[model samples]
Target: MNKKTDLRVLRTNQSIRKAFYELIQEKGYEAITIQDIADRAMINRNTFYLHYQDKPDLLDRCVEELLEEIKNAIVQCPISMRPFSISTLETVMQTILEHISHNTSYYQAMLVGENKIYLFQSKMEKIIKDKLNEGWTSSQGKSTLKISKELLLEYLVSAFMGVIIWWIKNDLPLPVEEVSSQFSKIVAYGHFKAAGIAVEE
Candidate 1:
């Protein structure tokens, strides 16, 4: 009976989440209401309130959960093995791409359309920035950087998000490996493309 109860709760949560994502994709966040979610999830308003304080709370929790997964994926990138290596960056990007592939709807709802949540983007960038900075602190050779660490990292994160959004909007036109590899190349060899400057590997 306890197991059945737990399974029911889990199922309800999944239903609510699925309904929320579908609604966000269909009508945008601002227009959604408690009744809308409950209707879509086939649950009562009281049930919705039992799980979340309100729509904002639901959005917060959903974003938090998804971002936590992204943080975990970043942690799995083996930054310690080669903190600033192109391969490490590629691995991290590919990991993120693969993870997003598993939850495309959530990302699409939060990031891809006119009604997308900018707050999600802002929060995600901060997480990525924090992780990259953490990696930089643990690694060496930062003394050789010609630009401020903050500026360089900000640039990298912006470009990183740009590539991701582009991929998501395009319905993932390129394979994850190829996109990650090209991204790394752009990061490591962008100056080469802009000018004749050769970047040492």
Candidate 2:
């Protein structure tokens, strides 16, 4: 009986999430109401209330689920192995790009629409920053850059977020692997190197 109840709950939540995503795509986040979501999901308003307090709460839950999915993908990628080298970075980018590509429509609705919901982006930044810090701390070799660790993390996170937003906004013109490769190359080789600036290490 407990197992059956859990299954029913899972199905209901999935329905609500699916309905919310569809509504966001059709009417945008700001314009979507709890009643609209309930209607689309074919559930009562009270059922929706039982699952979520309001629209923002529903959005938060959806974003949280996406974050978990991305984290899992990153963990499964070869990038999580060891030795934070250029290859590892490229793999990380590839994993992220693939995840984004897989959920392009949902990401487009949440991130690329005219009324973009920045909360999701902010949450992603937090997740990336935490993971980067963890990886750096646990890696065998530490970076010898003159910059502070915090500053480096901020730079990397900003660059990653910028690339993701750009890719989504442009409707992902280039393939995911190609974009990941280019981004990894740019990061691995500094702008000065690409610009013909000779700086001695």
Q: Write the per-residue lDDT of candidate 2 for residues 172-193, one digit (tens) a residue.
A: 9899888877777777787678
Per residue, candidate 1 scores C-alpha lDDT tens digits across 1-201 of: 999999998999999999999999899999999899999999999998888999999999999999999998888566632335788678878999999999998899899989898999999999878777776777766456777878988998998899999999999999999999988888877847645676677
Score residue 110 of candidate 1 by CA lDDT. 90
Candidate no. 1 TM-score: 0.89
Clashes of each: 0, 0
Q: What's the lDDT for all of these models?
A: 0.87, 0.80
For candidate 2, the TM-score is: 0.77
Q: In model 2, which range of ten residues has the least summed lDDT?
A: 75-84
Best by TM-score: 1
Q: After superposition, how far is residue 107 of candidate 1 from its true place, in Å?
A: 0.5
